[model samples]
Target: MGNQVNLEEEAVGRRGREVQRDGEKRGLEGPKVLREECPSSRDLLNSLRQVEKMLAVHEASYQQGLRSLRKKISALHNSTMAIFRIGKNASCPKPEPPGHGRRLGRVFGIGHEVHFLCKPTYELIGPRTRVCLESLKWSGQQPMCRRVNGTSNSLASFSPAAPSSSSSSTSSFPVSAALSASSSTPASSSASSPFTLSSSSPTSSSPSSSVRPSHCTHFLGSTRCTCDVGFTISGRDNNICTDIDECLLFPLGQPGRLCVHQCVNTPGSFHCFCPAGYDLARDGRSCTDIDECENRMHNCTVDQVCVNTYGSFQCVTVECPQMKNATYIKTSSMRCERNPCMLGDKACTQAPNSISFHFLSVVSNMSAPRVLFRVSAARVLGDTLRFGLAGGRGRGHFSVQRSGRQTGTLLLVTPIKGPATLEAEVEMSELERNALLGRYLTKVTLFVSLHEF
Candidate 1:
């Protein structure tokens, strides 16, 4: 009976190993979705559990097997990452416990910060640290992250790698020390294989694996967020910048996949970054316009157009012609001739100095409510004018007669006028014109005129 039990346990271990190997092959197939959880991931997690159980049950032959299996599990774990932003961060989630696999820092930036291991489980997407700067308020829209000032590479919290107070400091490296610690046991020798700590400088490695550089922060790409060449955020915008996905809004494929470059957005500006394209100037704040034309990196065809915006450049097949007719949203209009004594030279201008708004009085349909105009102008409170008229029925819109003056009377002197005369150029909308017929002419003219008085 003991032998049979051993055999059954051994069989399960062998099967688990096979399933895990299959998982290794499948996991590396492609890029996983950003900030999401999938069933396959859960399945992989379950396999790790089974492997852990198998090692525990079939204690003898599986001891050595467990070591090898653990290595593979770690490798698989480090290949991906999961990004789950907190709408309102509740309790920080524990990374898949122990054998669950390596995931990156779930809570990034500052604000109710809880320390969880940041492991590079998958490719980093969006910003690495959603840092809320202490210099900013929560309701703030543009949050800031510290970008590396230069090319310094140091582990963020390693005991030996304390940060320097100098303006230039090494940034956070995108490696998983804590995640590495998960698979490596307290007694295991292979622990250090996954994590390399240099005795001289316990900080992180170079260019790629670095932390938030001192005095600079703006990350939209991954856990290993390196800011664009220029632009640092100490507490500038308070780290409330919303992600402006360039791919979603603009066509970025031109000029050798321009969108492939970094698309970091600043408070009032943004830039497209390339790995080795150009470096920012010493100013460290503004993106010194890269003259792509001079860089020999431009992918423009022989006859194409190249237009330079603030930070980046674009080559276009069809250039936009200058605006021929731009529509300005209308805010105010005025009636110029209220009194018959007003127009020196009556003109049809957009904003006439002397003007008035007309109010609707009699309508063709009693069922349809009359439309009234709410007037607002600096001249609305001035002396009112009166103009009396003889003609009672024109059965059409009447024109307001303006008498000659050096300037026009701009006040609404209402006592004048009956069946008001109006200039006939303005027409109502199609719906309104149709509704105006057979209606009693409410004969009132809204006018704004400029008089010396």
Candidate 2:
């Protein structure tokens, strides 16, 4: 019976295991089935519509928040820049402690003014007050304190006696400190001192109180100071300051003047300039064309011509004849032969017996008769040929000269009558071995006509 119970228990356990296996399989298949069963298109569309409505409801608020955030960031950035004076350090000048003078407001800040005062018996020179300019500089130099009598030097002797009510009232704490500092320096009285002023006062000192030359009328204790950047100290002691000309000191490609052409130095400033053929551009540093031809500044005459070049113009004289119907042919270095005949007509002809030539008529209003024609020939027969004027009866009306064995010139004088024709004849005797072999004759005809001139 026990065996039977044990077998029954084993059977029951096996059946429970099979049931558990089936449940595990169903659990794994559940997710796969759900994944395969996609939602309907209509349901997806409905969900998307709801999302759109929600996004539309929040879009305006989100954009408004973004704009507000940007505004806040920009304001913060600007405030931070103002506080730090970013990008302004090099452009702004630092404050300089005045000697024997009183300064008000922030000296280092732009648009701030500084006023000055002198001791009772001293007078002030230069502007009484100066203001800081946008260029980061004081408007004027520091004023000097001179004695009332105008005979006291810049470093006048002062007694260490108790100050008078008037002297104490006029001097401020800063001014007094500056004056004291300026007076204590040994350089103030030296000849090398730039602030050394002439003194006409007689040498006189009281025995009860010791007196020393003082550059300051009030007490301000400080040592020598240097000038700001772009400035140099002048005068003997290097107390007088002046602006340095960067254009003159440094050339292009250096750390100074940026001018491309010429550089001009002005008071406390400098500028660029261009050459004669160029003009100053709107930028004031660059140069452009002056356009001499376009501006009618060229010296070309009517017969001459003008051509534009880079930044300048060129004057060119008409080298060849510019007549409408004539074609120019170069005949010599100094003259050009012009042909005015039609395409088929012969302008010049040469032959063994007769040579004929044609030239365009020239009309002039001048009184003097000009040379109408010129001809020259080279001898091929050595001394066997003789050339002379022949067919014209008015030979005396023209001047003739034999330049060489085969060369001659003909000049036409003032004509007494109308048109005339002239002819030249050449007679040649052929020779061989210095003996005559044959004779030949050549003739050339020239026609000359004069107008009313």
- Best candidate according to lDDT: 2
What's the residue-level lDDT of 83 in candidate 1? 22
- TM-scores vs. true structure, each candidate: 0.15, 0.26
How far off is residue 217 in model 2, in Å?
10
Candidate 2 whole-model C-alpha lDDT, 0 to 1: 0.47
lDDT of 1: 0.32
TM-score of 2: 0.26
Q: Across residues 1-453, which tens digit of lDDT does each residue of candidate 2 receive?
A: 999999999999999999999999999999888877987788899999999999987998899999999999999999777756743442336544445544433435665555555444454566555677766677988677555553333443332223212221111122211211111212222233323222212112421112222222323222232322223444443333344555756576554444667776543336677766677787666677666777899998876556554445555442444544445564443344545455443322111222222222222232334454444554465435434454344555555555556555555555543243454443334355665443333333333333221
- Candidate 1 residues lying further than 4 Å off, grouped into runs, are 1-375, 379-453
lDDT tens per residue, model 1, 1-453: 999999999999999999998898678654464324456777889999999988788896677799999999877766432222323443432323122222334553335321122122212112333334443232222222222212223322121223222232233322211112110100111121222221122122331222122222212211111232211222222211122233334445454321343455432124454433235544322224455766756788865655443334446443222222211222333222322223342322222223222322221212212222222222222233222232333323333333322112122222223323232122211112233111011123322111100
